[model samples]
Target: MAYKARLQEFSDTLDAEVIDLKKLRKLVFNGCPDSGYRSKCWKLLLSYLPRERKHWKTELEKQRNTYMQFIDEMIIKPGREATEHGGLADVTLDDHPLNPNPDSEWRAYFKDNEMLLQIDKDCRRLCPDFNFFQCASKHPCSRLCGKNSFETLRKRVEQTVLQSESVSRNRLGITNMSAVKRKSSSEFVPLPDGQEAHWEVCERILFVFAKLNTGLGYIQGMNEILGPIYYTFATDPDTECEEFAEADSFFCFTTLMSEIRDNFIKTLDDSQCGIGGLMDQLMSQLKEQDPTLWHKLQEQDLKPQFYAFRWLTLMLSQEFPLPDVIRIWDSLFSQEKCSTFLIKVACAMLLLLKDDLLRGDFPSNMKLVQNFPYSTFDVQKVLKKAVEISR
Candidate 1:
């Protein structure tokens, strides 16, 4: 680490906790170092850190507390009774599920179920091979509530209530929660079947995200997107223990989603900035660099989105192991270009499997591209190829 000039700058200013943004960016252009360096750099890249290092502590606290407030107000409903209908007060007699009122909040609630269910399924299945998402939290977590207890938030979470209709009102008049009451991870008590704790934390984060970003609402595959980020924070290096990984990760995920949300928004799919347009750009780039494969894929009707959509949206999480995904992210975060390197990487991957792809028809090609070509799982090698293509 000391061998790198920018890293040396980071070390020299360790006491002040300041490093040159341009230098830091240049240094990590290839990728950040290990967890301690990567996590900190990620915070900076995501704007979690202010330009003045002195304000880092204050800024981080305020943002993380705000994220907690997001959970307290949005995920957990107040003054609402928990019912069998997913925890909101029953759709009134006129506003019931059968109600014909198109403008009814109850009607809207029911409609949101399709979106919520899709998010739930994806979040639950996110990185199941890992025990962190699969098993349970090491300790039972405390709920986010007011000074005393988050009575409303607790009930809603306990009942899995994600789509309450009174979003505007609840958001406007959120019950005040104390920032000082933030609990350290050490405060948690373990449970026998503690798996619910981690999932619930993830659940609350996504739900809060949906409520806050009404334009995008919750979208499928976001869980996969959030997985590596939370994992990196939660499993930080011992020197830099993260007592509030959940809150910090929430902020980081929000910043990340803001950049990539266009990919998930269906209405924006065809816009110039949308995923579809980017796919067009990617295909064009591939044609410029690897026209043979591009023509072959188009001949077989293997459009970019068929495979690249997941590649771009989840930051390629689904196609690579968690560690490899983290490594790929290091490169993505470093590049100054609009992450076209991701597309270049994908192109390199296909070229790596050019022989097999050329031999197979659409189905085999689809299957091969959908999964990272087993021969190209070495993200390091693929990344090297990706960089050469980018150049």
Candidate 2:
């Protein structure tokens, strides 16, 4: 069968208690290696099976404990004593302890490992779209919630959002206000009713992001990014076949989300170690290639962060067409090492518009910088050029 047909078949079979363990094994092995759970692939498969819910819950708890141990180990290096405890710790503690200020730590972490952390957060939040085990109480992941338990916090969020029908509907904009306003000249137009549909989309997106990035929780901007995905999937379920294909889309999205989460949730500190270094390299190259533009920006006291931050952060989601975004993402998944390729794409985009950039006025140049791909640059061409440049 063709790939889409096979995917549809799998979706149809989602409720089946008797899974083809062999096929399940293949899927897990194929997908889980890069996730640092290669050895735990079998465990993940077992945990997902219908009969294993109780055992899965227990195993998941054990996994959380293991995750906490790993974090503790990293924080207190070997041969060093933990400050809290007198005994030798597994890893060295930071010279400065994590402060109570949430934004400070988040900002610092994002600045350092921008790519890795964003991807890490995005992946965790969106995994297993319907039954998200990662962010639920089932998983005791300290990396996400810190001291506050994930389950308790998640339940509170659900209750707060779900309890008030009026709030949920208004928040989701389920009502056509313009249409309602057209019919009535009332000062306060009531919101249209469709609470269940609104909540379904909201919850699914929330669950996806929450499960994918346990550390970050649900930030405000996440909803905006996910809005399009939810709309595209759920708006016309009958026509889009989303109802029939929900399971497949869920799994496919889970796989895709795993690949790109780092781009979304990173703080400045988190990028310093990985793509952060690459960003520095790219900036240097840009300076060498376009010193005039580079110097112009410096003369204005404008840093690359002002313009290029979103590009690096969201993997061009805000800039490119959704179709183009999907294509680029497909390429990202195809390549084992995609970071360098992404940088090359960024370079290609800059190079493609070099002529227009050189001729434009300061304001125009700034505008071009602000709206990357500026007018006339082709995303597909740039992506293709990026692949070639990386090679």
The best candidate in terms of TM-score: 1
Per-residue lDDT for 1-391 in model 2, tens only? 5655545544433324554545544443223222222212222332322333346446444543543443343232223444465334344343223544553433333332333332222333332233322222211233232542222222222222111112222211221111111222231122232112222333433554444455755443343345334333333324422331222233334444455455454453247543355566567766766687666556666555555555654556556765455445434443444455566667677767677766777678767766776346666677666756655
lDDT score for residue 299 of model 1? 92
All models, RMSD in angstroms: 10.2, 14.9
Backbone steric clashes in candidate 2, count: 48
Model 1 per-residue lDDT tens digits across residues 162-280: 32222231111211222233332332333344234465556657766887888888866778778888777767774333556677788888988877788888777778787777777
lDDT for predicted candidate 2 compared with the true structure: 0.43
lDDT to native, each model: 0.65, 0.43
TM-score for each of the candidates: 0.77, 0.45
